[model samples]
Target: MSFNFYKWLQEQDDIIKKGVLFICDSLFVDCNFKGYYIEDNNLIGNVLAPQYETLKQYKELNPYTNTEHIRYFFELTKAGIKHVATVLSYERSKDTMQVCLEEQYEYITIENGVVEMTNFEPLTVLIKEKFKL
Candidate 1:
């Protein structure tokens, strides 16, 4: 199964989709994903992206949220990227990984916040070009 952004996104719950949008928005604002992935499931004091300084504050701001749940989705996205790179024989590096995520986010933006593919070329083509596949 190849990576299909819209299909993968449709499988997520609403909260997780919102979390991903938050991540994309953060990246768009500052081009930084410094602490998006959480290894220990500890987001309370951890700086997750630039906008939300801490998960505690994020929760306070957005009451109907589970930080851990959102973190899980974040990890899933990261793992999916790693899997794509491996399957496509692309060298896994920080820069390349960031590019993959950025391109996907840009695709979402181009779709007017929808997870459809309309304005851009097939995602595989863009990613293949990056990987030289």
Candidate 2:
């Protein structure tokens, strides 16, 4: 199947949120305060670690911001952030995603992809909105 960045992000977010809830429930049942944060580390190591590495690999392959993979990853991250915010009951903000996109664009060379420099700004804004960031 084609790489669906937004879908991947949503799936990741769902997994993380469910994991968090499970951890929270476990803590509550066990009355273990110290263990409250324990699951987070495990989750990060087991789940996020691999995904992070995959993103890094994509970055390495592209080596520039404008590649299709880079853009896909960027959009995915924004979706992830939005999912996190929604789960946490916080209003989603696109500021962080925008900053990241801008930074990515800076390192992008003409060989990366067909996207234009001027297009980056608006794309960031659109991604944020698309993800409810």
Candidate 3:
């Protein structure tokens, strides 16, 4: 069967749609998703074009959103960004995977906030390009 955003979005519950929007909005307001595919029981692989935004925008968009049930949608969005969403969503200062402080990493957290990336350098060119660094 063919896929469409409007049609697929319609199939999701309200919370899922909201979750999708919230995640996308944080990434940037102008995300262009080409399509969605599947892996195991979860949805995977949507060709997306996300415009770069300032760290202030990222901070403003991402609060400590207590998304317990709707986490799957966030996970889907995170996957789209190759898990940069996970780094962005790390609120705790003590997380094991959290390599450094927000102060150390401009735009990596809310405080040192700017569009320029001085922290959490990705290993690959694609991930760097994804974040628009």
Best candidate according to TM-score: 1
Q: Against the hidden reference, what TM-scores do the models get?
A: 0.24, 0.20, 0.20
Screening candidate 2 with a backbone cut-off below 3 angstroms (N, C-alpha, C), the clashing residue pairs are: none
Q: Tens-digit lDDT track for model 1 on 1-133? A: 1123223323432433344445344333211223223222333575533344344444455554322222222222321343121101111111111123333522222223333222222334434444344
* Global fold similarity of model 1 (TM-score): 0.24
Better of 1 and 2 by TM-score: 1
lDDT (10s digit) by residue, model 3, range 61-129: 433333211112122223444332222222222121222111222222323322122233322232334
Runs with alpha carbons beyond 4 Å of true place in candidate 3 = 1-14, 39-133
What ranking of all candidate models by lDDT puts the best one first?
1, 3, 2
Q: How far is 90's C-alpha from truth in model 2 (Å)?
A: 20
**Per-structure clash totals for the candidates:** 0, 0, 0
Scanning candidate 2 in windows of ten residues, the lowest lDDT window is: 30-39
**Poorly placed runs, candidate 2 (over 4 Å):** 1-3, 29-133
lDDT agreement with native, every candidate: 0.30, 0.28, 0.29
Q: Kindly give the stretch of ten consecutive residues in candidate 3 with the minimal lDDT sum.
A: 67-76
Model number with the top lDDT: 1
